[model samples]
Target: MRSLMLASLLTLSAAPALALAQPGKDCHLPGTEESLRCLRLAVPLDHHAPGAALSLHVTVAPALRESARRDPLFLLAGGPGEAGSDLVPLLNTTFRKVRATRDIVLIDQRGTGLSGKLDCKPGKNAETATEDELLAETRACIKGLNKRFNLYTTEQAARDIEVVRAALGYGRINVWGGSYGSRLAQAYSRLYPGSVRSLVLDGVAAPDQVVPAGAHDAQAALDALLKQCADDTVCAAAFPALRSEFDALAARLAKSPQSLTLPDPRTAETTKVEMTSMRFIGTVHNILYSQADSRRLPFLIHSAYQDRWQPFIARSNVSRDFSSEGGPAMPLHLAVVCAEDFPRLTPELLAEDTKGSFLGAPQIMRIGKMCETMSVPAVPYKEPAVIEAPVLLMSGALDPVTPPRRAEAARKYMKNAQHLIVKNGGHIVSPLGCMPRLLRTFLDQPGAPLKAECLNEIPAPTFQLNSAGPQP
Candidate 1:
């Protein structure tokens, strides 16, 4: 689910067929009412390839009922590594109101899904691998994929969307992007202003703002945990020195890491997770994505300090699993972020984002290092052509990444926008709270008046930090 909709289509061709009586490939998608169909217009691997053409699959689940169809809403999936077309099941309910008016469109991105995915799993999953086995694995994966793979850049993807827009014959469409998809939405708005009518960016990672780096975001979970403890009579009285306790836990692990043997999902074998400050920080980092898990951060650390390893072990791996489908998504992620976000990083620029952010820096640095070797021709970061469009930006106050401050920072660039700060809501808010209803209303009006009260429906913060578990 690397958020690669054009991963399949764009890598192949750019020559539109003008209407080739439907190509032969079957575009089957379950749980929808329409038949899936596909056709490829050969696109060059290098845009320089003038005549070479490749066909990519483009499938759609037309509006279930003609009575309830509105202009389509294009779903832009997250995961600088997730597949846009593969998110249908995850979104049907959240967008039900909007769906009553239009079809939900899904497109497999270039070099993703069936469009020639960049998945490399056999190496990491094998039972025979030793402690030092990844180098060969990485080598094999690289050589194997150098074959038919083409541009994995967002610029290539933008062009692919133009082809799909023309083929489908839609003059304007509503776009909804979550997390990294939000980045794509911004890019699209800049590149193809005429194509987008309305936009919904959840977990807003705006184009102008620098993505935060370090453990400061994770530190927010610890802060959330402290507040939760203080609010609860039992917790406040029981763990009064929560901050000291957490700091001590980190110090202890940094000095003496526990060798933990846990069940491995890859092969159902026992694997060792040696505790470290970085691992601990990363564990806290995962819970920041959702509110439910962030609550568990306190309990996880509290348990870890008492020498009960289970809780900490569990929380450690959540972000990794959330980021991947138990496979190799890191490389493609590098291709995108290395190109779009942090390329040509100045030391001062990196420091600016990391300042006071405990959890943000590590993640940002991790991305930066990974991106160093895989840099592509950079695309110019452009501002949205029209800030006139009513935009709704959502953020969780306690969210580790894309926190309220980050959301507010993005708001400054918008000429007209509503900034909804959910007291304790985590990263993803579109599918929850008053967001669904507000979104429905927004789309219903098209380019109409304002409605600020709907945001009132969001539940107030009753902050809690439960123990998060090891990630996948």
Candidate 2:
């Protein structure tokens, strides 16, 4: 799960499309011990043009039994930029039971993983790069790409999924998509309804959702975290001034960005970081994605308020690097965001969305500037019609980005769907307690009642009050 959170922050790269490979043979995916079969299928860069092609990397974890289900499960990755192949380890663990009867297919969506990735050199320090610097870097990256930036839209990616599905010889497939992948799953289902067996969308990002509007949801999640700490007796006693301390820290950083030398969390070598209020808040936002990290928030805040910045800096460094290690492909991220998301973001809408949010509108503004340079024509928004496929939508009640309400919004367009909200879960909840089993059950029997009462047994994370850990 930590890897999943960390991978969310990394970037992806791409090369020119290559010729399709022969049938799959044994292969090993990085970070996992499991042996899998790998295949490379050449796909058009632009489905409409078919002039140039990019080979997509696909991995197959075969079912244990020889007589497996005919319809396999396809895993769609999030980020709009994450390579589905990067999630093999998490999928192997979370869907271990499901693998007993169905082959699991993981495809590196066109511009990610072993596929034609869109690698952009990061700024000297992307974490602290100024808005102008970031935008300039984006422009340089766009100029350097061999492929058309506008060609990586979700619509095209959906078509690519069909191509892969056909090449793999699967008639219909069950899809499990997370975050931005949820939106992709919706697009794929809409485009190829007959090819889909069932859909599982975790952290649902609905078709009509404005990507920039996530600032509002993040703020709501932060507020809930603070409130939870206040309501907890142990947390309240340990950090009586936690809320005030956080505000004071943010206010102090806002007025004067800190220049500090701290050991790198990964290397332990001396490192310098420019810590601004936005950076501080952004770090906290990322931390909120995992229950373990959220548990340490009170301690992290109290320590920082006392001018003990090492712990906070180390955590921040780790978070930033995690995002970069194998996270999202920035160029591809820009391509999708510019084409599909930015069109719906207006200055008026952004202002309203970011009001009172710690993150503010800087991200939206930065992306808007980058989008301006890319010149990727905006994909028009369309209210998704009813999807008749049996769908299971799961959401974390405390997820910073895709809240339960987003799942509810998505459920409206599904003719056959069930939503399950994990009470103490955050971000992607499919891999949370009892969820993996519940998921396997749902896939095996889409219409069966989810015996999810066990979720109630999952306790709220114990807040870290001191170095010794939570009070007994």
Best by TM-score: 2
Task: Please report, in order, the local distance difference test score of every candidate based on alpha carbons.
Answer: 0.60, 0.80
Residue lDDT tens for model 2, 217-326: 88888888899999998788888888899889888887888887767666677877677766788789889988667888899999988877877876776645213645
Top of the candidates by lDDT: 2
Give me the displacement of residue 112 in model 1, in angstroms.
Answer: 2.6
Q: Which stretches of model 1 miss by more than 4 angstroms?
A: 1-57, 68-70, 122-144, 147-150, 212-218, 237-239, 255-257, 261-271, 317-328, 355-357, 360-363, 380-388, 412-415, 449-472
**Which portions of model 2 show Cα errors greater than 4 Å?**
1-21, 121-138, 263-271, 321-323, 467-472
In angstroms, give how far residue 345 of model 1 lies from its true place: 3.1
What's the TM-score of each model vs. the native?
Answer: 0.80, 0.91
TM-score of 1: 0.80
